[model samples]
Target: MARLNVKPTRMELANLKDRLKLSTRGHKLLKDKQDELMRQFIILIKENNALREEVERELTDSMKEFVIAKSLINELFIEELFVGSETNVELDIHEKNIMSVIVPQMDFNIKEADVTSDIQYGYLNSSSELDEAIERIESILPKLLKLSEIEKTCQLMADEIEKTRRRVNALEYRMIPQLQETIRYIQMKLEENERSSIVRMMKVKDMGTNN
Candidate 1:
């Protein structure tokens, strides 16, 4: 909106012109980056939403099975059932770069070697409902880990996109305009100075002829 306070000269004008060109080019690059970031962010969001829905559905089913099993058995026995049973899930996390944003790539490792023996309780006393519930829950661990990874990536990308948008807007609305205005002002001043010099030269030549 305002021209920069600079000395009016051809040199200044040339410098301003170069700056304006650079600023314009930078603006285009930043705008393109912002657009591409948005595209990737949207794709991640969609995947996060879908994976979340599926994980929630599976969790609900697992909870239902547990509830049914609890109702059919003695509540005291249910507490003792899983007293000695435990499964450790470990996350092997790695970083991935997406459009300059670093996101987590998660892999879950189940510690127990024998998947079937994960149920520490004796089968004779455990209800079929309990078994199915435990199995389903164990199966969901990897998906849950994956869901976390995607959601985290989405969050990181969203942050990056916001930062990029602000830079683009600053260049487009502020820096570029100010540089262009300053360049124009310098060019006009230089032209006026040139005209004044020509006029002075002509007056001197006329005076010499009159003498």
Candidate 2:
């Protein structure tokens, strides 16, 4: 760390000391905040990994079911069945604060009961595989929404951690050291001035005694 460019004086020393004290305290607090943010970030990462794996597995299963259904049913009929279905989903978004970082929160609401209910198509013509696939996909919606929220939260937290880490490094490596060095220089100058003044006084006193 480079020493600060400052006047070597008692007043400058006092000011620098005060600044050093404040900088040290701020650095400690920032360090603590960074640690906590890392902890939360790690936990979110783990959750994201696990949720991603589970979602992938369920998606594979659903896709397999869909493929089987497609093979067994008429392609035109399947397309018509999907085109006739009406389903609506609403999402509510908000924010929650964690360790000074705001992260997203989401809530999903399905507009109609039929969204998850049995398919309206005639059973005589439609295969059960299609119904099973649709149901499986519908069941995974909530988890998918939750996964989205978690992933976004993790991103926000990671950004905050990086920001905090930078601040802590600035204080520890630059500002605090500069202030300390400046204060030491000022104290040394004051001590030297005091010693010089004492020596002059003693010489004057000895000359007066001889006269």
Candidate 3:
């Protein structure tokens, strides 16, 4: 509550009053924005947590199947099969706005091919476990990518929410109060000046009447 270092005049008081009105309105709007951002951020966090859990569970299952496949197949044969494999995957990145924050959206472009035919190794050479493992791993890639995108979005939104919260607090606690104090100070000064002028006029009239 420090008063602003401004001259105590009618025009200055009027200006301060207008500025306080604008500041109060702006504070309300900013507080509302911060509240909405927090709501949206919480939703994103829950979604990220669920997606992360699902991705982890699928990855664990896929890894277990891969370990079993490795034990059943020749190590050199596994290396050779992967070395000659042809799988094309492309990612297209784009942006989307959530509450004025731009976040990333990713889309996968997988080249068209017969997945069954793409298993280049002979069916007899590779166990069914190996085929299943490969399929599961491939299926997890898109989900993993989606999880990455969601986590990043959550981080960015969290940062924006924090920034907004700081601004709202500053306006609510600091600027508005200071403006109010200054306005009160100016009004008091103007009232005191008005009383002094009236008293001086009364004294002048009394002296003239005596003469």
Candidate 4:
């Protein structure tokens, strides 16, 4: 925090008083904004916690299904197999801004991956279970992506909230107090100066009357 310049004179006292009032008003407004942001941030944190638990549970279930499918495929006769052609899965990426912070957007063409080339290796006619597993994994992908989005947004909001909180505290606890103290100092000096002027005027008047 930078120190405030408080070189005030009687001529500039009115201006300082007005500025003090404005600063106090601005401090109140910023404090209100900070409080609101904190409230929202707390809510977001709780939501993020719930989403994390859900993703963990879903991933556990998915891994179990994956292992079962793999074991079944390995047990099947080798002569009854058909091999499928592989294709590269391309992902499109974009950026979205949330409160001036940029976040990533990912697009996976799962529909394109659905079309598989015929293969010969197993007695089974098709990889229906494997396809189902792939689809399940694909379904979970969007949820995971959504979770990432939520987490990042919450992080950005938290950062802003903390910054706002610091400014509010500085204004409320430090800046305003120092400004008030300076105002008091200037007021006291002006009062003393006024009393001295009155005393001098009375002394000069008495001297004139005597002469």
What do the candidate models score in CA lDDT, each in turn?
A: 0.84, 0.86, 0.86, 0.70
- lDDT of candidate 4 over 122-177, digit per residue (tens): 44533566656656766776667667767887877778777877888887888777
* Structural similarity to truth (TM-score) of each candidate: 0.90, 0.92, 0.91, 0.76
- The parts of candidate 2 lying over 4 Å away from their true place are 113-120
* lDDT of model 4 at position 33: 76
Q: What clash pairs does model 2 have?
A: none
Worst lDDT window (10 residues) for model 1? 113-122
Query: Compared to the true structure, candidate 3 yields what TM-score?
Result: 0.91
Better of 1 and 2 by lDDT: 2
Q: Over the stretch 1-211, how does candidate 1's per-residue lDDT look in tens digits?
A: 8878999988888888888889889989888888999998888888889999999999999999888887777766677656646688888889998878999998788866433433345555567787788789888988888888898898888889889989999988889899988988888888999999999999999999999
Find the number of clashing residue pairs for candidate 3.
Answer: 0
Q: Estimate the overall C-alpha local distance difference test score of candidate 3.
A: 0.86
Listing every candidate in turn, what is its Cα RMSD in Å to the true structure after a full C-alpha superposition? 2.5, 2.4, 2.3, 4.4
